[model samples]
Target: DALYVGNALSYRAMAYMDLARMFEFKRTGVAYLDEEAANRGIYGLTVPIVTENTTERESRDNPRAPFYKMYRFIMDDLNLAEACLSDAHAVSAKTDASIGVVYGLKARLWLDMGSRFERYVDDLNTMISHEADEDLNDYDKIGITTANECFARAAEYARKAINEGYSPLSESQWFDPSIGFNTPNNSWLWANIISTNDIAATTGEWQSFVSFQCVEANWGIAVYQDEINYAHGWMIDARLFDKIDEGDWRKTTWIDPEDAGASNAFITKYSRGTNLSYNEWRNYRSYVGIKYHPANGERNTSTIGNAVSIPLMRIEEMFLIEAEATAHTSGVGAGKQLLESFMNTYRMSAGESYTCKAADMEAFTDELFKQKRVEFWGEGIVYWDYRRLELPIERGYPGSNHARQYRFNSYPEHVAPWTNFYIPDRERDLNKGVILNPDPSQAIPLWEGGN
Candidate 1:
């Protein structure tokens, strides 16, 4: 019962954190507008907060909370979880909310809260800062005031997770047929396990089975066997692919652009019995990822192939957060040292040395972001980080391979306002006080800068 409650609280806190990131002011994507909104208290809304103490009637009338209140609510849940979580479970039990998971979550939360410290810090406007509860008063000690304090807390919590003895997966384990991403390992702090009996597996309709491109499952036959000309397989942007160094093992995660013919193993293996023409069986798609394959190296045509666990939190993420937080809290040199240490320990090959050439904090963070994108591709993590960093989506460059409809640049100055979700009509209907976000769903034109 104790473990269950702790796990529930941890998951709840994660959900709230997602809400805070997703629904914060759209204006914050731009620097000048962000400062203006922070000063005027305009567009600082996030999703509504609900707790066990709240009645259903109260929920029906609840308005979206201010961003600061939502941040506080998430922190409260994490604090409760930290107090309640058990250290009995080993890190290998990746589905459980172990102490490492709590610490990692704290690190992630503090890193995010630190990014926009001006808005997250409580002031006299709403005045929810001084609750009579002693636990609420403990916020200062937990590092919730200045940006430096928040980063320090992030680094501290991340180190706590690292000290739990969890290490990154080795290269041999990266695409191991026996262990292939489907099973939980010691490297993960938390994961969502999909059992053979689960509907996702039983139906063989999960995105990982059909959309991962390299898996020989479901609609995947269209790509591997050339049974049909389904051109909608997941692929990486050409610009991003070009940026990856050839020496980096991660660059091989995708199909090499030079190996477009029947020489590719996927086409040769599956096209043996098919009546595919010479050109039909060839893999024409560029930069499609092959990192995630069916379990046991078996074709995912069967139900068993669909049984895979998705990692929610990994030990490597804690390392990244720690390094980034340290860079901001201390200096670029300290942060760069940690980055190099991490690479040498986990990512580098024998006799290979890694160095950080970033001279300033911005350059250091840019390098860190690139490393993270390559490391965690197809894991649904880069999106949050990109949003947090206010990076422009530049897919409209020359020689780009992105789909025609999506090939547009979305700079912060122009505003990709649809990045923030609108409140659903059903939700607004249920909660009368809820205000819907402005719709920004129009098609964006390709940016023509420097053309």
Candidate 2:
């Protein structure tokens, strides 16, 4: 019971921290919003970590607290959970806090805390210590970075988790549209199902917007409507699609207008097959991908749309994280070598090979970042890295159609405006503690280890 409560609280703390990172200015205890840059109707602002009053309203109305206070709240919840949970790897699923899950969550939280990210090295080691197979690289290079003096221990923990039978799917497996949404694979670690008989069960969508993101054409039509509006209009940014090489299996994730039989069109893994009527498929053109479980498909009945599982965390992420950690802590050579090995094993190419190398460490870091963005595009992991690094994204890059209205072009260079959201006026009026972020366009430096 204590473990359960602690885990739940940990989740709440994470959600709060996520919002703060998104909306709050790094140096100031406020969300970024210059009066000249204000936009309305956004809420879900950051909360105070230190509490003087226990009442709901006071907490809601209070201004954003110091970073230390917020970090304390996050740590307290996670620490308590760790104390309550056993290290026996009990309850892999939902019955109780599995030791592995706790460790993984702590590692992620510590990384977010920046100064404490190295703490993950320890938790990862704890998890790795329990592995049945001591050989971290024995099974196709799935978990942890390459073994070396700096990251060997962390690699051990990663190897243990990978030994638990998690890995990335082969390119051919990913290319198969049928059974794409099926679960209990060699790769996926944690997953949750989108049940039918729920709002997310609507034929054209899932609760997480997978249907919206990965589906297009008649395949994505409303479960009830044989033909209707496009589902939610979500898609991969065109510039992101450009990064994939022609020979790479992931290139199938998007389609060029010419190949798609029209301008701005492409094929995606969202379909069960290319067996659809030409007219039916034309509507989708180039706007679909696989992560959204579109292959789970539209149903004849609205009562139950696509029944599919969402991959919450995959070992692939750990692989990438290890590569990055190795690069930063161990050195570029160790990081590069580990990343290259992983790519050669899992992300091999048919026509085009993956390429990223740098003469300088900073340039090498850039290469690593590029690989990460490509590898985890639809998985929803890259944006946080951009925020943490204060990296600028080029929405106006060649082949991009990102709308200008949502972009902040006030400064010398244009900036992505969607990076931060605004706090609704109601938040300021109703909650005395709220302050609107004036400029969501400009990047905020890391609160720690940055000037």
Candidate 3:
């Protein structure tokens, strides 16, 4: 019970830190006093913490307070969990696994928060060190400063999880059509598995819910597919993909055909057969439908296949993060040396010769983004990268109106008109003090007329 509650609380805290990092601007550049003022003011003025049993009066008076409180509570709980895990042996089946997960979550949260606040750097460094020490056995035998170190850490945890008998189902297990589609597999680290009946009967198809198509079909969803796409695309800068020699496995796996309109082809890392509809039908819903029909199976029953485990954290990201962080602190050359080692391993895995020299800082950074994008295509970390880097959203790649439209016309701009529009009630309530809403005419145009 203690472990469960502790893990849950820690995960929640990590999520709150993630949100604060993404939504709020960094407090690092501000004056020390100003930073303190902002932190204290936000902490005080913000909503009080509340749980499921929060009173209605408390909620009504300070709606946002509970969220803030919950974040604080999460941090406290995570600290407690770390302490508890330290003394206890790994006698329980799930204790060690939960501890590792909590450590990873804390590391991610701290890393993100570090970008926003100066104090968070020390916190993040501490967390990373703790995780590194705890999960040392999982790491590949490599020097700490090398690019391989990051990959080694990522791979270590991932391998530990797998070796401990927690792994995602293989492609064959997920695609096999002989078993019932609902059969659960061991690969899912954590998931909310919904019923087939609930899924098929829903108006939105599975593909519509999970893929980039979700944005086009429904604007209501907060996360945009284009944002995700652009974020991932930006990571593949000239340094990484452009430098790869012809016939490299990463080039084939990481990059799609760079063509526009009908000629464009998507990278295959996240690509399943056709769309989700076809894949769903192939994997589940054995009945012959418009989208899919089993080669042989009863109605509504198809051979059970393995589901793709949405990798929350893999070995690859750790490598990139370590390399990037080291590059930022140490010289770019040191970082490149680390990156090259990983690249060599990657090439060796594909039976190819690895050859590349890390020379310029700009080139190294570019390569970092490229490798990250190719490695973590669909797992949803791209937006975080852009936010951390403070890069402006570039529309339509290097040159194009379509790209500009997509980039500049963000969620804030779209919602601003509605938020800051003139209010008739305000005008009526305070005649002499009527709020002067900015005119639409004065607003900067995000893009010129048409493509």
Cα lDDT tens digits, model 1, 1-451, are 7777888989998888888777665652445545654664547688888878879899899888876666667777788788887563464467778888889998988887676663434442333444333744633323344777778989999999989888898876775655556678878889988777878767745354534534334444435544454644567777677877655655656656776554565454323322234464355466766566555544635567667777898888988999999999889999999998988788876777788899998899888988898888878787778767777677777777776666667775333555766668898899987777655455456555432
**Given candidate 3, what's the lDDT at residue 289?**
13
Give candidate 2 misplaced runs (Cα > 4 Å). 26-46, 50-53, 57-61, 88-97, 115-165, 176-186, 202-211, 216-234, 262-279, 286-291, 350-355, 403-417, 439-451
- Across residues 9-88, which tens digit of lDDT does each residue of candidate 3 receive? 65555555554443332222224422553544432222234456666554544322222233345455566766555433
User: Which candidate tops TM-score?
Assistant: 1
lDDT of each structure? 0.70, 0.51, 0.39
* lDDT of model 3, residue 342: 67
What's each prediction's TM-score?
A: 0.85, 0.69, 0.52
Better by TM-score, candidate 3 or 2? 2
lDDT of 2 by residue, 81-127 (tens): 65665453444553233444455555454445432233235534533
Each prediction's Cα RMSD? 4.7, 10.3, 11.8
For model 3, where is the 10-residue window of minimal lDDT?
284-293
Q: Sort the candidates on lDDT, descending order.
A: 1, 2, 3
Give the residue spans of candidate 1 off by over 4 A.
28-42, 89-92, 118-143, 204-214, 218-222, 262-284, 413-415, 447-451
Best by lDDT: 1
